[model samples]
Target: MKPFFVILLFSFLILIGCKGEEPLNDSIIIEVKTAGEKELSDLINNRNGKYLFLNIWATWCLPCVEEFPDIVKLSVNYKSDKIDFASLSIDYIEDKENKVIPFLTKMNTTFSHFINGFKKDEALINFINKEWSGAVPLTVIYDSSGKQVAMLEGAHTYDEFADKLNTLIK
Candidate 1:
């Protein structure tokens, strides 16, 4: 009985100590092309009428992490030929697959991720919105003709996001 108890205790300890997978970081990493000029131009030029929702986020940003689930929900709810959803994570290049991918995998996020590799925060801000104050969890909605329709900064609820999307869709 004593030997059996010891073996059970050892097994329990092993089970407690051995995690099945590495700890998931609550962040996502997006991939950015080094030569984004062409891509950016294409995105801008081709957005003649399709609605684009560009969300800029980071792995370390708590609000960004919190808002992602709703973003995913919104994507699922608003499936249409005129709407496009893109999530761009501003996580550092080094943390892309290591921290970001694992986190997204753990969260089961279905949205496509992209890395914004531009080092200059100001430049990125300008690229997204000149009025943007370099805030995380920023959402920019562009109309089909590449016009800024709505912009929301900070975390928002699924209902609020859905409402905003509904406004655009209608």
Candidate 2:
């Protein structure tokens, strides 16, 4: 019984230590997490001390797919203590396993990712930003206080992304 308990304790310690928090040495593959509007809102609101770089995209959106590698690059090159990065996939919830995850994996994304959970497309758009025209490649920046500081619609260059984030961080 004591040997069994000792083995269990070691296993628990290993699990606790391996939370996948290590920095990605290479952009190879990653599993995207899923969240609804409320959960996503909460994530944004909770980023109080760090700048938030949130990009709204979809697997099927041509520009979104085209711009994905750049987003991943920014996440890697600009990794900092004061800034954070995340990507939100607006793909259908049913396609996460088949479409969304595979796409992200193919992109070798290192940053944390999310798949939108809203069943209604309009509601998701409004929840993100009422002014948005339901675009597939939208980007928004939030300051340390979780207030939106900048936004860019459509596909953007790596410099564009870095420049906007630089302004906010400064």
Candidate 3:
């Protein structure tokens, strides 16, 4: 009886020791909503007393993918109350769940995310910035008053992002 009890206790300890962490897929949840020109505009306009850092990207854009991890790091380092971070994916609205959300989940992003819902790509570009020329990896910064303070086109490094953000803070 004593031997059986000891074995049982040893087995329990081994099981506990071997326990693994939950898979990232099971632990992280990310939602990607569809946003049209009006919806995007609304988000840009509604700053809620915090500076907004919005990145326009797509799942298929290589530059966007390359720079995403830096954006994630920036989002983590910045104080959330002073600056809010979000991403807008130009990937098709239908891919929001399977492609966009999955990519964002893999990146461990928990901020607001949206997929393009505009009927015409031109409308979206015009709404964002007529001068944008429909480029991916566009970073737009808005002040607390919902004013566009800076518009950066193309992929940027972490230091570049930090410099821009620091100027905004100052």
Candidate 4:
């Protein structure tokens, strides 16, 4: 009986120690994929019953860098079954490891993001929106049926994002 009690106490101590230990930072991996015009078209066409919020940006763009945190905030706050968030970096595909991933890591981004793999800039530009002037920090939202609902072409606040999402979601 004494031996049994000792074994039980040891198990409890081990469990408590495990509970107090933090997960290794290296265990969390962030992978940013590359998407070409065809992949982007497929994504926009198939939203899987959720409103898609797509932010087109580039690491070299100052406005995009400044507006990223707010987009990150919205991704955290508004993430739900009704809506999804994603980002497309216009940076050259070669920058995926060095520039794009590092920027996303700094932003603590968890949502799916991709680096543009389009060979021709005009192809990507027209694929996204015909009227878009190839602008950085462009945000567009699409409903569940894959129809574009909003096109915001500049940096916007967290509230502005929330407001637009709220109107569509509600």
Best by the TM-score measure: 3
Question: Which ten-residue region of model 2 has the weakest summed lDDT?
Answer: 22-31
What does candidate 3's lDDT look like per residue over 22-65, in tens digits? 55677778877788877887888887788999999999999999
- For model 4, residues 99-163, the per-residue Cα lDDT tens digits are 98878888888888988888989988887889999988899999988899999998898999899
What does candidate 1's lDDT look like per residue over 111-155, in tens digits?
556777566777778877888888889998888787788889998
Candidate scoring better on TM-score of 3 and 4: 3
Q: What is the TM-score ranking, best to worst?
A: 3, 4, 2, 1
lDDT of each: 0.75, 0.84, 0.89, 0.88
Q: Give the clashing pairs for model 1.
A: 30-114, 30-115, 31-114, 31-115, 49-144
**How does model 1 score by TM-score?**
0.74
In model 4, which regions exceed 4 Å deviation? 1-27
Pairs of colliding residues, candidate 3: none
Error of 3 at 114 (Å): 0.6
Best candidate, lDDT: 3
In each prediction, how many residue pairs overlap at the backbone (N, C-alpha, C within less than 3 A)? 5, 0, 0, 0
Please give the lDDT score at residue 34 for candidate 2. Answer: 76
Residue 139 shift from truth in candidate 1, angstroms = 0.3
Task: Please give the lDDT score at residue 124 for candidate 3.
Answer: 84
The stretch of ten residues in a row with the least summed lDDT in candidate 3 is 20-29
